[model samples]
Target: MAALPTVQAPGIVNLSYAFTNEGNLLYREDSLNYQKEVFAYDELNRLTGWDIYDDSSIPNEEHSIV
Candidate 1:
């Protein structure tokens, strides 16, 4: 799990990550705030859904890929 830079609001530190070999982003965290998100993908490398976790590390919301 490597951290990738995020281009969100200016001066806002955000961190995204992906699998080393698959290059699939599995999770993202806001370095300047409390936002933890997870991304899911199908076998074909297509996005399936996404899960949002609160600061407590509990899933709070989810949305399917369109």
Candidate 2:
């Protein structure tokens, strides 16, 4: 099985990520640090969008897609 990728949310709430813009992350956030949203991926396991949520088990503003 493939190992899980690391997720991160390193910034203040309602504020943009210190490193990059949020739009590039493919989801609008009410709070980048606190908002509950999940990463949406394609069948090939590539990120295609986001599942905006009021609650989620995930947190992160950006992803390092390689």
Q: Each model's C-alpha lDDT? A: 0.75, 0.44
User: Which regions of candidate 2 deviate over 4 angstroms?
Assistant: 1-34, 54-66
Candidate 1 residue-wise lDDT, 1-66, digit = tens: 455556567675666555525778778887667778888888888889989887876789989987
How does residue 10 of candidate 2 score in lDDT?
58
- Return the TM-score for each candidate structure: 0.68, 0.28
Clashes of 1: 0
Instruction: For candidate 1, give the lDDT of residue 8.
Output: 64
lDDT of 2: 0.44
Model 1: per-residue Cα lDDT at residue 49: 97
Clashing pairs in 1: none
Show where candidate 1 strays beyond 4 Å.
1-11
Candidate with best TM-score? 1
By summed lDDT, the worst window of 10 consecutive residues in model 1 runs over 12-21
Clash counts for the predictions, in order: 0, 0
